[model samples]
Target: MHRTYSMRQSRAPTASQIENPPPPPSSTKGGRLFGRSNFGHAFRKGTAGAFGPDLAKKLSQLVKMEKNVMRSMELVGRERMEVAQQLSLWGEGCDEDVSDVTDKLGVLIYEIGELEDQFVDRYDQYRVTIKSIRNIEASVQPSRDRKQKITDQIAQLKYKEPNSPRIVVLEQELVRAEAESLVAEAQLSNITREKLKAAFTYQFDALREHCEKTAIIAGYGKHLLELVDDTPVTPGESRPAYDGYEASKAIIQDCEDALTNWVSGHAQVSSKLSTRARTLSQRRKNNASKRGEGVDLAGQDQPMKGDRDSWVAATEHGEIYQHGQDEDEEEEEEEAEGEHEETNGESGGGLSLMQRIGLQSKE
Candidate 1:
């Protein structure tokens, strides 16, 4: 069989036949088989082949999607960073506000201590005034009792004797005692009013200052609260800060009112005292002027009385000189008149005392 195969062996296949013949395209049931399409093969041979374009397009779309996702992530990260920065800034602001509030609270505590001191001072002043009034009242009682006892003693002494020096002394003592007692009673009443006035003045001043400081503290606290609650960005928005500010302003206004009232009252008191002091000064000046005038009048009267006495002495001396001269002249003339008197005796005997006086006057 091998010899016969050799004998019947066909000529060696050509180079083309040696290779296997190209397989036929497989047939599909209702259409051409899905092998490599001529159009697809031709397209693949060019730069824009169908499968190549589709693959490149898919790759391009995936790259674009990845870039979009990355961009979105980057934007989200930036937004988160901004939010975090805002939160950090807000947190710092909050810390500052808390610190400020703490400081304000400390100041408020100090102010409260000052207010307590003012209250204590006012209470002490009241106590002092009360003590002063009590002392004055006690002093007045003794003075009044002494004056009454002296008056009764004087009346009893009067009944005992009329011309006794004891009665006179007793009356004088009663008068002096009564005058002193009346003065003491009046002064006691005045002291009470003065004590009340002084106490009122002190309390008013202290309370006024206390209220002012309280207002300042309240204002500071309110401002601190406003800072605490303030919004960073929205200036126009209504917030707790605005309400706190308003409340602070109201407190300040109240303080102003209290201060105003206190100042006004103080001014009135000062004015009144000034008026009284001026009146007292004028009265003292008037009294001094009257005393000076009285002294000058007394001095002028003394000089006039001395001058009148001197004039009367001079007139008496002149009359004494005239009388001595007349006596001397009569003695000298006596020798010469002796002879005439012997002849005139007869005529003079008829002349009465009135006629002799008339004759002497003629001579």
Candidate 2:
């Protein structure tokens, strides 16, 4: 049999509740007709952050607000189920098509209410996790206060009695307090990160399942709407007798089956990011890949000046060698021309004009 969960009334315990019992959402409500007024919420809102240690006040307020939200959701779920029952009652005297459809819709809407109740339970899981953080914050506050108080005592003693032996004792106490505070701070950091992640993970998962199931119910409801004959008929002639009982039942059964079989892996809807988001994601991936490569490649990728220096040094060495060769060739040609001029006896001196010019330039 399909499970038809309600806002668990004050009746005999079900087998499921007996095994791993949790408080029903009904336990959180005011039991009165209209529930509590906003006055209680306003009073709580004004006072939540007014007490407690300064470090914990904000988180304490957040915890208080979450409680308010849970109570509100509980009220909403309870009222929704009532509305569903009223819908079925209103349709009891209508046509057969309207009657069956409204009854089936009531079932689905009641399921939504039940799901909301379940959501409140799961939401409490997140809220409880947050309260742990607030508790830790409150616990750590004492260590901070002790440390500050000891430091102040040491400062006052230094001014009144510089050589007081009690200053040494107080300083030692201050050191111990600081060490304890350090440990507390570290624990606070680690637990805060861990619980924050876990809390949100539970919340988003429940939300996804709830939304998907609601949409499935709506789709089936639309299918049920098709059974109604909207086409206009003659005033004197009545329309054919309605005979969509089996079809509507089949649709409702199909909806029940779909809801029963649904899972995260079988989810049909998907979310798409914007083009800019995709681009940024790709860029981050590229950066991560580049970082993963070895250090040698990373060094080559960097804009190092060593490469330019190495090339410049090689070019300078080549230029110096070529310049020396050219100088040697000029000296050899000058010697040969001097000999030729001497052998030809074409000048008064044995030196050629080129040699004389070279010597004059050197001088």
Candidate whose lDDT is highest: 2
RMSD of each: 67.1, 39.9
Q: What is the lDDT of candidate 2?
A: 0.62
Scored by CA lDDT, what does every candidate get?
Answer: 0.39, 0.62
Give the TM-score of each candidate: 0.32, 0.68
* Tens-place lDDT digits, model 2, residues 174-246: 9888987776676666667877897787677667777888898889889988888777878897777888867
Those runs of model 1 whose alpha carbons end farther than 4 Å from true positions after fitting are 1-100, 122-130, 151-172, 230-363
Task: Kindly list the per-residue Cα lDDT of model 1 for residues 1-363, writing each as its tens digit.
Answer: 000000111222222213322122111101111122344223223322122122123322332233233223323433433443343333334444443333334333333443443344443444344434443443344456667787787778677765678877777887887776666555655556877687667556545545555565566556545646544667675434322323433443443344324432333223245888999999999999887753222222212223211211233234432332232234225423434433231110111112211221121
Instruction: List the candidate 2 regions with Cα displacement exceeding 4 Å.
Output: 1-35, 271-363
lDDT of 1: 0.39
In model 1, what are the clashing residue pairs, if there are any?
A: none
> Candidate 1 at residue 269, lDDT?
28
Q: Count the backbone clashes (under 3 Å) in each candidate.
A: 0, 0
